[model samples]
Target: MNVLPQSKHYNLTHYQQRYNWDCGLSCILMILSTTQREQFLNNFEAICKEEGFGSSTWTIDLCYLLQRYQVRHEYYTQTLGIDPNYTQHMYYSKIIDKDEKRVTRKFKDAKAHGLRVMQRTVDMDVIIKHLARNGPVILLTNASLLTCDICKRNALEKFGYAGHYVVLCGYDMDSKKLYYHNPEVQDGHICRCLSEAMDTARTAFGTDQDIIFIYEQQQSSDQ
Candidate 1:
């Protein structure tokens, strides 16, 4: 693993998600920096909506959004089909087939855009290396195990392991903590969880161990 940045030094602006389903999109906005986004952010939201974001923000859907903005990154996944945990989701029964088709089509579109989608698993070492290089990582995690305030407040945890995306900002080896920005809350920046909990929350069946390894310049007026 590469030398990790001190958690206190990783300073990405914390942009909270506006809705329960927009966490994935919000992660992208935080990575791309919302400062010069007067026009960029508007178009970003427009493209997100144009590409099936109003309903749900799937992993492949995020790739399409990044490609549209000329963002540099690799889309990684542990599965190439419908979310295996679809059966556990609230509306899974009605939307399994539809969600599968949508995921397949958008996946192909993401490829046609020349985005590199890597099919494999990622571990803590990989996440740390990217953070060491000052790159941002967007991770899919089970919200239930994350001890999220919003989840507790809304009784969302009752639904069980809802899949959510967060921006992994840094880690503290000494503290054995994984730090990330949970868009679900207003003070989501650098929210810390035990290293064990982080792995468990993200590697669950619903997650597919999905990750977006962004290789942007880390430049933004806001940062």
Candidate 2:
């Protein structure tokens, strides 16, 4: 039986990020706090310190943090290892090595802890499938292309890739819109963007197409 998928929405308490680089953590908290789990809800500062949050964080760090909290999820990234091409780019050249070392450590730690890391790019179809199956997602995206409130409020012109995190909670097929919580907002709120634009930001350069597809339980695929 073919079941037509309608708009899917999940309840969540928005968490506007506290720090410039903590959008990823804030997004994770937004989803987890909405659920029964509360371990991470009240430990924002502690988690940041433990995770060594700093100038920048990577997809691997997020996956490892999810594992640390015993949350079930699948980690996907187009890059199997740190991309050498990033170091050559002027925008990231200064911080690329520092980020590389940190992310490499997290990658090894996540694997050592038995998390399955998928070496693949995330696309719109995959995102839609996850939502259809009742799973929420947090993925890296280019803020410049995302064009959130800050972009419009500041009348900013899109130029370089500014990597940020966003949670995908729902989608309306009829409207061709994807809905998610944007932790970048000063006062957190659900953000809606065109599916095509969202995918473009998700797969943008510097993002590395990194994403975390979360399951609703613990140890769902920890083998």
Candidate 3:
């Protein structure tokens, strides 16, 4: 395991997504906030629309959007392929119901943007390492994983086992706790034990493992 940092955190309360479907967007905003980009902070929805993010957004969509903005980023997943059953369910339930042609076009557009996407099982150690490097991650997990009672209730009522996204901003290795910016919760930030975080992360629809979106901004020569 890598040496964990004592403590790390990012203030991203102002970037909370207004719509339930905008969690991914909210996480993107949180990441951009770290760069202190005012344009993204001021025009979130317009930027979302420009990125072709609809009611239901996928990690891939986010990757493309970040690439368009010249944000160096990648998405990590436990599996290289998506589960057939989950894909069928998403299509049938209209969770990702969209024009096939349009979706294909958007995917191609993202690919052209040169976004880097990687698939691998991630753990607490990896998360902590990233935080130590000052890289915030977009974590995908079930709403039940959150410590807030209201977030769990909302997750149960509105999402119901569906995947959710949050920003992992800090960690306390001494306490074995992970901190995140959860858009669904009232306070927007939650902390949980490492074990609990891992358990709830497996609640996602696919391989029942962890998936994350990470991007580190490149520093300029002038600086």
Candidate 4:
């Protein structure tokens, strides 16, 4: 249970979602806030609209945006056994359907923009490792998984809001608490028990696994 010495939180009031379904975009903005990237800050909405990220944003949409802005990043999701039905349930169930072929195209677009993307199944250990290194992770989870009572209640009222995203910024191992930024929450940060955080993250896609997006700034020399 290693924790960062201090919390890394970001205030992204300006980037709050204009639509109820833009949590994914908001989460990405929160991560970009950490880097203090002026370009993204200046043209946030334009970038989102250009990428066609409105009601729902997929992993590839985020990767493409990051790559377009020259932000180095990677994406991760637990690998599940080959189950076409399960895949349909997770992605195509929505009104805005995304098939494997569409998803693959998004990945190709991101690569074309020069973004490094990777998808793999990872355990809590891997997540903790990233937080230990002071890396902010974008976690896709059910909005109800949030510890905030108001947030959970709102999620219940909104249809199709079970799927949401948040940024995990830090943890206090000594206190066994996890700190994160909820774009839906007005407050800058929210704190909950480490166990609760993990439990909520497990609700994603009913897989009880994590869908994580990690972004590392590319060194100028590397570019």
Candidate 5:
């Protein structure tokens, strides 16, 4: 098992709770925040021990591999010892229905008129809507690309994909800039050219129509 720094390990746990999304950026932030590199290596060893997995090299790589494997492995269920079928049913009937439109005809009677639908909004739109509701939405997004930023080019080179997920905490329609919560940057906020954000939004989330409106909990809302 490899040791990982204290700060890095905590960052991974913290970001997972905060972002609640699947993008590797949370893990990337974990690596970036730990000041003690050796301590960071130790943390990976701890994770492997708890997960009952081993690695050729005990380092952050092992932590990454275990987490990824657990997501798909049947052992994930065996360890929990709970049938996930009910959860899957609830996921389809309730959670996903609330967030996304289910267009698959198999879900309905054959003679019913089917409707074209869109899925959930991209990360930016969700964050923006949160701000609208709360008047100061603070959210993290994994940004690995920028059209003009020099650092962005380097990130792309290393990551082999421009699939950066950026936070849009707020938007200024008049100024045409979107504010972001970027964990990778020392600065708290990064301003993106609106067009660039739009382009990224199109690539990251294909449609604006499926934007999930944040209705009041008491409000009767149906998809």
Candidate 6:
């Protein structure tokens, strides 16, 4: 979280310095490392001191920090270090129908089973409770129409959602936010806002539906 110099002043050497530490090349090269991305402000100040610079800028270099964090996060997830608890939800064509407008009931069934596996780790009630105890749970959601709407219904009817697979790890109730991890960003963009994310997800899945699924949170552990 290094704050960028407000006066457009920068330490060209530190900025361009090649990292020679034990950190990964990406992290060393990147100004803000993902391991410390959450504490970006503090990290920025440290970087300034280490680089023999000062900060007097109106706005910090949040964009760069966010970008670098995204990259490190992706590298962490895709590699063997990905946490098993992290939740991920997505929807794809089930049967590859004539316009691919329909999902195969079989595939949908499998997805529901996957959701069950996720719940086995932590039921929706537990997830909500954890969120209440913790903070806003950052959730990564698959905003596709089939995923957001159809899958839930299918999950309820067929004993589980086969097309929609959800994984739960952390939650935040205050800001009504959920954290999720996805490996889809070209240069360091990851995670999506639930509000607008649903719309974008729907478009990716080829749908005109305005449906947004709400993952309810509870204050009590008792369901």
Which candidate number maximizes lDDT?
Answer: 2
Compose the digit string of candidate 3's lDDT tens values, residues 1-223: 6554577665444356687687777777766645444777677668767766556676677676677567676666654434336656743246534534445565455446675555567766666777667466776666653453223432344444556677776666676666677765556546444635544555456433545545455421110
Each candidate structure's TM-score, on Cα atoms with residue i matched to residue i, is: 0.82, 0.85, 0.74, 0.70, 0.32, 0.22
Candidate 4 lowest-lDDT run of ten: 214-223
Which one wins by TM-score: 5 or 6? 5
Give lDDT tens digits, candidate 1, residues 34-122. 55444556665666567765567788888877776777889889877676667666745556655677778777666677989878897
Each model's lDDT: 0.72, 0.75, 0.59, 0.57, 0.31, 0.26
Residue range 183-204, candidate 5, lDDT tens digits? 4444433444453544453343
Residue 131 of model 3 has an lDDT of: 69
Q: Which segments of candidate 2 are over 4 A away from where they belong?
A: 1-4, 34-45, 148-156, 218-223
Best by TM-score: 2
Q: List, residue by residue over 103-218, the lDDT tens digit for candidate 6.
A: 12312342343321111122244334533333222222232322222123211333222212122223334443333322221233223234233323323322211111122222
Encode model 2's per-residue lDDT on 1-223: one tens digit a residue: 7563878876667888877887887777775634423667566567767787564777777777777777789988888768888988776787777777777776766667889897887568778878777478898988877854333522156568777899988888988888888887766667887788788888888888988898775322110
Off by over 4 Å in 3: 34-38, 41-46, 79-82, 88-92, 99-111, 148-159, 187-195, 206-210, 213-215, 218-223
Cα lDDT tens digits, model 4, 1-223, are 6444444333333345557777777776765645544666577678766776545566667667666655555666553222355545544366334444545566666557666555576766666666655356777776654564334443345443266667776665665666666667665546454645655555555432445545455311110
**Model 4 misplaced stretches (Cα beyond 4 Å):** 1-15, 33-45, 79-83, 86-92, 96-102, 149-161, 206-210, 213-223
> Cα lDDT for residue 82, model 4?
23
Output the TM-score of candidate 4.
0.70
- Name every residue pair that clashes in candidate 1: none
lDDT of 5: 0.31
Q: C-alpha displacement of 164 in model 1, angstroms?
A: 1.0
What is the alpha-carbon RMSD of candidate 2 to the true structure? 4.4
When summed lDDT is taken over every stretch of 10 residues in candidate 1, the lowest stretch is 148-157
